[model samples]
Target: MVAVTSSVPVTDPTLLDALRSDLRSADYTLDGVRSLLGPVAADALDREEALPARVVTASALASGADGRATLLRLFQLGEDVTRAALDAVLPTLRTAGAERLGLVATQGADDGDAVRAVVDLSPYAAVDAAGEVDWWIASDLGEVARRGALPENFVLGVGGASRTLAQITVREPRGSVLDVGTGCGIQALHASRHAGAVVATDIDARALAYARFNAALAGVRLDLREGSMLEPVLGETFDLVVSNPPFVITPRGEAGVGEFTYRDGGAVGDDVVRSLVTSVGSVLAPGGVAQLLGNWEHRRGEDWAERVGGWLTESGLDGWVVQREVQDPAQYAELWLRDGGITPDRDRARFEGAYAAWLADLDRRGVEGIGFGLVTLRRPALAGAAVSPWRRVEEITGTVAQPLGATIARVLDAVDLVRDLTSEALLGRRWQVAGDVTDERYFTPGEASPRVMLLRAGGGFARTVRTETGLAAFVGACDGELTGVQIVAALGTLLEVDAAALAAELEPQLRGLITDGLLLPAP
Candidate 1:
């Protein structure tokens, strides 16, 4: 068996060292890039000492092409950003028939130097620069002459999901903030921009050290802990808990060539993500909020929303759950298998073994499929430990930091006012059944929904209205201007059914919709 260690040690020490030693290193500098349009805080890390540093890549600030290709194109944009400090490595990289050295993290990559000796100044630093980014700020350190972003594991960059978590996080001065699975401390770094105190935790020691170095260089204080979620912050509670946990459902005990310490969260299935969610509840003060990125099982009989909702239920808090993306078993399996697939000399045996292991683990645990994305929860204010659950389905993509804090505050302040809610249901009208929105599988106790729901077609705010036939008819009549009785009467007239019978049929669902915020009555 080949040697695969959990926490490998790096041999180098500074920024330039990592790059010059590699076959070819790369980073970028663009001339026309705009600076922050407003007055922004300068020099974020100033007081702390450098333990060691590495660039915790969030995403390739989107430049061109698609997926990975777009990332490489982004690299081409860095012209002057890179230091011509040594220019010695460029010739060697060229002679090696590879790209020039751009920027290098002081510590990362199996073959690269550990001490940061090379700076990844290549333009690819901002892989997905196209998304909603407030400002790309880096702590300027005099000790190291490099500035760039990339994972030590060399996994997916700060793509849409990473940026989403950054954007959704509430930025405010608080007593403390904990960034679990602090990949390169992007979220922690972001928190340091405002929070009074910051603590970041990661199972990967290298990652923890990088977070420490970055926080120090930025002149900020972030308590960096090297351990699993909550374990690092045990006996602690915070005003805010944010994490981009390693929710990738890699097969159990599966390790490969490039599955860097950066992304993998390490719980068999949805366990890691769920653990993060549940733990945040325990560590957050009442009224404190926890925002996390995760992946969960889209089990045969379970409702994804409800499954996530249940985490909130037992947590003694108020919760908001949103399933941003879902992937089928095959598609989900292939993406991760391929992630491990890209490493050097990776073959079918390794890939298939990893994939099969993942399947088997899920099968043993009774997990039907895997789903990934973001979820946010707010610990309840009341002391009885009863959970006040509120849910919504929102794109929230294209928004800024303001919405996250504001929306959560709004929800909490008006938590008593809103009902069982589904944004897709309340935002539009005239939704169709059978064709408009449908589920893949259902639980029957009949008979609920199933594995996945198909959105066959839609006109306005389309969603699989999770109500019965009678409830759908009743909801169609509620435009916030009708009472429950009035809605039932309207449905009764349209269906040529008795009003009393229709009311009786629709009451349970109507109550649920109102409770979940799907249907709002006339004020």
Candidate 2:
């Protein structure tokens, strides 16, 4: 096999045009990337055995869709299979379209690789400085086989986590937002939409350059700071912070990077994320929120939730940690090793050792599993003291994404526990829950020692009232048009219970329901 290279001849006008059209269409399909020029076919991207081929086929997903949607869907192609696909396609495109590829490099002046794609196509240049990350997206719906073959060396592009971050990020105009690792700068660019200014920082100068160039091309303003994590933003607090730092528990090199700069953080696994969280509190302004994607080891005696929960207990912040996915040690080992291209035929002992280390790391720590999800922190009021560590929400991603910015503003404005929110006014309506009462009613009678039953058939916050009769029938009478006194008086007559006692019980229970968000206080 010989390396194949093509130089674009100006005389071949039609071929260039066709290539351009393919790129243009792909770019559109992929979100604003313009085009994807491969030096060879995609199939042989890493085929040192096959690289020299004069011509082969290659595919670039193209860069032309809205960055968030395009990249999300493309990278969503799972980890393993996506890699194999890029390997197969890029080499072919590179060799056959060498002429066009040269033009791409020379024209864009970005020939130096760092991993380039039309958003959905790829993120970090698949080619790394050493060009040794052996990520190969597989063929077949292999390895859950999502994502196409990616440049083995370069970091890969956006995925579901990135999209979730993009979606939940409060879309308010702010002074600046820092995308800590700035892998592909997706967060930085996304922040630019609502933020007055955006800065993307990364220790990888190569990544910084790609971020700057990509931002410029897309007409998004950015301050590309080349420095490690939050250090560059020292002394300067941001209105918001977002990061998709490298949290692959597996170390690079031995594990082989799924894409070098992208996934491999350092030998200290997950150090990038820990650093980001511990220090992120300082850079966040009062009311500022740092949204981060991370993976925490499930330590033996220590809980995965507790590890992450601890990260959020900064001096001045209220935090929420949602643990979405967990993978046991064994399952985790095989999954990532596969990403590193650890074939039995290649190196057995080394791969086996890597797996052993991973398992040992987990076992030593008493980690039952690995947990992944979002961590959000808001700067706390200076006067407040104790910060706590806790595991609260299970549906972390969905819950965060559910909050409308305006609604969140309301939550922040409350400035008090939700239960205390007695009166409610919204969108031109007034709501109050007074007559609602609760009763610990019983079913199947004697089988129950006792049961507290609650029912709120109607009324704002669905006015809940408990009944010892299993349904003291107090809630059945909340007509917004009438006052609590009137409804209670009527229920007293109907249910034959002391209406005043029922309404009193109802008040506390209904308030609790409103506080819990089981019901939205009607406006």
Candidate 3:
């Protein structure tokens, strides 16, 4: 592993206190920055386009802006600031203190004249089940700020994948939680809110250093360690584990291909993700859940579900995989290539070479496509509770609501509720359509009955199920007023069919709907 000797911020309590006070005084927060930059520039910055923000902040600086703008220009835009200006903005910490904290480096021989931020510090705000949080996170500067490719061991700030994992993670309070591959400690930081104790591990020392600094900045304690994957937490079980692992599949020993520690796990194909899925069960406490984001290969002639399901089968834990997106070989190649800051517009030769290498590497492995998704695994709370582990692999390639942790928890509970239920037992319980569920019927011209029926979920995976006449009637009658047996019998009588056969056909469907959160056990 590459060891990064880059400047990492120091965790000085007094300096941290001063910095926090100055940040609060300046109103340097998520909403504060957005309000200062306006919607257009803020949105552009979100897209990693820095020109709009540069222009706006330059204007603000020219007009003798406040401390927020000064800090924004220094940290977010990677601009050099006059030391005097920084001193005025951060009066409590001042220039000397910032230098001591390793947040900035003085330029030339004149220490009081000019300095620039060595780290990226920004405001973060989010509301999960635990409520609202506003904190400052510090990590290495990004590609846009650096104006070039990232180093192999570069510690990353909060990105799309991290944010997605945070939003989807089950957020119930727990005794112990673990964050594997805790880049910038974003996941660990989120876990700290509800968990009594959080242990975060990373293979990169610089990452751990950044995580340490971030934890200090946020005033949250984390047990930080340096190791790859589960090595740091072996033999110790956690109530919950969350990871945004380095699951990106990158080619090995190919010319013009470089490995980035932040994304590459140095494994062939998708072995990294496979290993994690199969082994994470060992670290999970009874009834503990592990949530991860990963990329899996779609090889030619091999079903993706079977391939991923094989991993779950080896795990001996209940597993659910939701594939949110699929990309063809070329699309995936270009995406990661550009992500590494090698763009066709910037360097055509290098881009084409690396792109060809990616295609060749994937073609060698018979990889036709790449799948990106979320993985949730749980160890059965009771020994011998399940004869076999339950596994569900599905594709939901549409927009879903954020803060999906609660929805996922409900789905897990529903799975357990129906896992051991017989058809008769399921029929004995009253069921109701979820509040987010609605049905639509399509009719042919002049037809008395609808030609097609659809059941749609307004939340969760935003799933839509096509329904036949019998199933439609059954679902329509599910008002919690009658048991499943009564509903199916009524539908059968109304449709002039055998009640037993109807029940047999709709039993699996009802279980599916319940697990997908379209139906619920009535109180």
Best by lDDT: 3
Alpha-carbon runs more than 4 Å astray in model 3: 1-5, 108-112, 344-347
- Residue-level lDDT tens digits of model 1 in 83-134: 2222333433321111222233222223322323221222112222122322
Which regions of candidate 2 deviate over 4 angstroms? 1-27, 30-153, 251-260, 267-271, 343-350, 380-518
TM-score head-to-head 1 vs 2, winner: 2
lDDT of 2 by residue, 249-275 (tens): 764444432434566577465567777
Q: lDDT per prediction?
A: 0.49, 0.50, 0.89
Tens-place lDDT per residue, model 3, 1-523, is: 1112268899999999999999999999999999989999999999999999999888888898578889998888888888888888899999889989999887643535777888899999988888998989998887777777777777889889989999999998999999999989989988998999999999999899999999998999999999999998999999999999999899887765658888899999999999999999999999999999999999999999999999999999999999999999999998888778878787788789889999999999899999999999999888676457778899988899988999899888988888879889998899999998889999999999998899999987788999988878888888989998888878888889999999999989989998889988889
Clashing pairs in 3: none
**Cα RMSD (angstroms) for every candidate in the order listed:** 12.8, 11.2, 2.6
Which prediction has the highest TM-score against the true structure?
A: 3
How many clashing residue pairs, candidate 3? 0
Ranking by lDDT: 3, 2, 1
Scored by lDDT, model 2 comes in at 0.50
Residue 300 in model 2: shift from native, Å? 2.4
